[model samples]
Target chain A: MLDTILSFFKKKESSKDVAKERLKLVLIHDRSNVSPQFLEMVKGEIIKVIQNYMEIDEESLDIQLTKTNSEDGERMVPALVANIPIKGMKNAGR
Target chain B: MGEVIVITSGKGGVGKTTTTANLGTGLAVQGKKVVLIDTDIGLRNLDVVMGLENRIVYDLVDVIEGTCRLKQALIKDKRYEGLHLLPAPQTRDKNAVTPEQMLKLCDELKEEFDYILIDCPAGIEQGFKNAIAGADKAFVITTPEVSAVRDADRIIGLLEAHEIRKPRLIVNRVRADMVKRGDMMSIEDIIDILAIDLIGVVPDDENIIISTNRGEPAVIDGKSMAGQAYRNITNRLMGQDVPIMDLNVSEGLLSKMKKLLGFKTA
Candidate 1:
């Protein structure tokens, strides 16, 4: 698959490419350094935290540990972009 | 008393071995007594890359296990008089040697060699810890791709956590043509993503592949552009201001004169 992609555009499989590809995998694994089961457990715990207060809007709720790679700013942070539909009146929606 | 440099990348086959072999050779060629240690343990291959595979009888495990002394296991490079090799045992796994043992080995080596270059194993496993245990500084090798850049960033995080500051980036195997065609990520892109100081950039050369097979590092031949790049990196290590080669720009008369006259690249 990587070879296909390498051939697709242009092959920049140089040292820079080596570093770039390696960093991607490293970042993902470095976050937990554990198995997928552990990640699932963490995800479930996070969902439970949100579920304790109110019902989750499954479709709109997203809890992800995202990595942002900017020129000057690169970070690994958990993003909780969720929308919980409250069971209150229309005026109660802030 | 010189420095111990660990050349590492969390991803495998990203030229950690190649960088170690080349940089070690370059340092030795510049008259520095250097020892290149392969800390990969069972999957030992740095010796093969350095053309010292045939001479490895007492491996790293042997040195650690008290089967042989450190000096006895050190394989003197036949090509470069000042260069030495401490081959990893192909028989034993990483557990056979602990990071403390590796640290002791490097500390013992410090008195003899000017530079101790470690070819670190891939992944942040016990092997990686063993590789970086006694290093004074590190060079994180990476290629220009999303995955490699991400891995480099993670490795940088690990290094920082361990307090190994200023791990310079060595961008290897860069293809100038694709970069020019806007197909591949530019050096600027990789550096921007990693946000690290660039130490050197090596162009992807068929000669490196050929040299690996030949067991003769092309860095020995200054004619090869990749060799020149490695030499320049080593010179930079030695506090020389050797310029990075212009792999993309044509070495036309003007550029050649400018490079010769030590022009600061744009």
Candidate 2:
């Protein structure tokens, strides 16, 4: 079932879709009043700090940044959200 | 109720004043009382393009400074009875007028005209602030070029930041032939990028230069296809559900002309 659904959307995105995605990213950055370089620097610092005290596999970790509709356009308030895959926390508990 | 609309583009030479003049003329031609105010102090051109420079006994500065009455400064167009102009002070700096003063002046003008069109200066500074201080809406003008669109995007961002919504777009200098040849951006591409409602699309015509020289807008002449587009926009603004001019009409003309020229519409 998943294979059928995945194949259905495996088709390439239209040129219009590509252009809209680019515009959305640029507008998000512009509206948030934050530079892409600044976002990168922030993501790097937050990931580095999160890895220090976590019992998770760094290689299988993913950290993504996004904008949420807030009171202001975008306050640039960083959210330390991550999905870290724990390799063997149960085995370590023993 | 009088609606104040500002024609603004953050970048220079994107034809803000020209769009303001033409739209004002279009609205006036439709029998709506329209007054175009040039807010590009010390470098005014609405007066020049509208051909009312010599008739400007007073300007925005004069009204703000209490030197003259607002009606005294307004030069009514003899050609179009409903059209009026409030020229910018060519000799005074932009600092001569404050945003508050502009707001009050617009409030005064609102009582008189159906539409008060403000021609904003380029750049996002005090001049821009003054231009938008009292505007009920914004008509952003941009050419179908990367630089112009980018500046327009920036201007739209500023508007969003300032909580200015419902800002419509006017894509000027659009050459359909160039767009077909992939040399110019299409209307669809622009609207997709800007994410704004397309209000008007003015084609690049040599008659614009001639009309500017004559102080007559191209929209007055039915021969100019671009003029028809402006007239359509004016009708749309006046609470009328008029269809788009170029997209439907010009395409038919193009296919017909192409067939005549031994070219097929594929």
Candidate 3:
């Protein structure tokens, strides 16, 4: 109910905004030369590794290939960043 | 030395050839000796666009292949004393001429012409490589659409990799009415994403199609809005600071309705 009220107050995104957002995401993948399927595979592996020790919120996990400026600000380097949320640790009750 | 400028757009049907034809004519009108090279092999249209298709006895491939001299293949435009065209061979594919050959050709033409404008073929392939091979500068042409802009970004990345730094952009076929309504991407929006220096923004005009069909580039028509835009771009290219065209169509439906209802608007 609160989210709906806040969203109603927010300005509607134009088609240009949607295009820019989509292009930004697609370009990140293109510049890194990483396929979406490959990213999904990597995400699956990461989730499997974490599942061995902890209970993770799979729905909240986010992984993406992005860019960062080099130390001297001369070059843009592609970086793979991931965020995985944890709900609880396995065997905590034991 | 002459400046070899490649008009390239990664996606097809964006107006690279039209820009090439207009810029060639525009620069020549400014008393600059200009030569337009059609590098889009297997799909040659520059000659047709320039209305010099019937005069092609020899082509770029023939010059490179040593069958004909460079001068023999260059078709002189009837209107301009300085403007010339080295058309692509419609029969041959892109593999017919190599990048090294294109570089040598540009070197030879540099001595005679003030500007050598190469019309690049679509896609990042061998044809594209050959087009940019001899170019000192590149003008990326793209529309306001998402796909064209995305392709332009990719082309820009490739240009950077080839060490062709400081590429300028030409935003082509922009609809003023659509932009006013936020239905189309504005020049500012495109420039913000592309992160390149803007040379000019050409407004979408119906007259361009008419002029193109007649094989006379719109830049020659003083009455054309698109022609004025091209002329401004030409002046800008010659190192003059020309103002961008005001693309706001003032007498739109809203204004008409307001006028009918007697509501004065600013």
Candidate number of the best DockQ: 3
lDDT of 2 at B116: 95
Clashes by residue pair, model 2: none
Q: Output the worst ten-in-a-row residue range by lDDT, candidate 3 chain B.
A: B257-266
Clashing residue pairs, backbone N/CA/C < 3 A, model 3: none
Off by over 4 Å in 2: A1-94, B247-266
Instruction: State the lDDT of candidate 1 residue by residue for B1-266, as single tens digits.
Output: 86899999888888999989998999988899999999998898998888877887898888889999888999999789899998988878788888888888888889888999999999998998999999999999998766676678778878887889978888888887877655567666676567777778899888899889989887897678788888888888887766666876334522543333342431
Residue range A1-94, candidate 2, lDDT tens digits:
9756754664454443444455556565564453446556765676566556545676666665655554544334334356767654443355
Residue B68 local lDDT, model 1: 92
Please state the CAPRI-style docking class of candidate 1.
Answer: incorrect
Order of quality (DockQ): 3, 1, 2
Tens-digit lDDT track for model 2 on B15-116?
Answer: 888788888999987789999989998898998898887898998999999899888998999999799998888888889989899889889889978999
DockQ of 1: 0.19
RMSD of 2: 10.1
Question: Of 2 and 3, which scores higher on TM-score?
Answer: 3
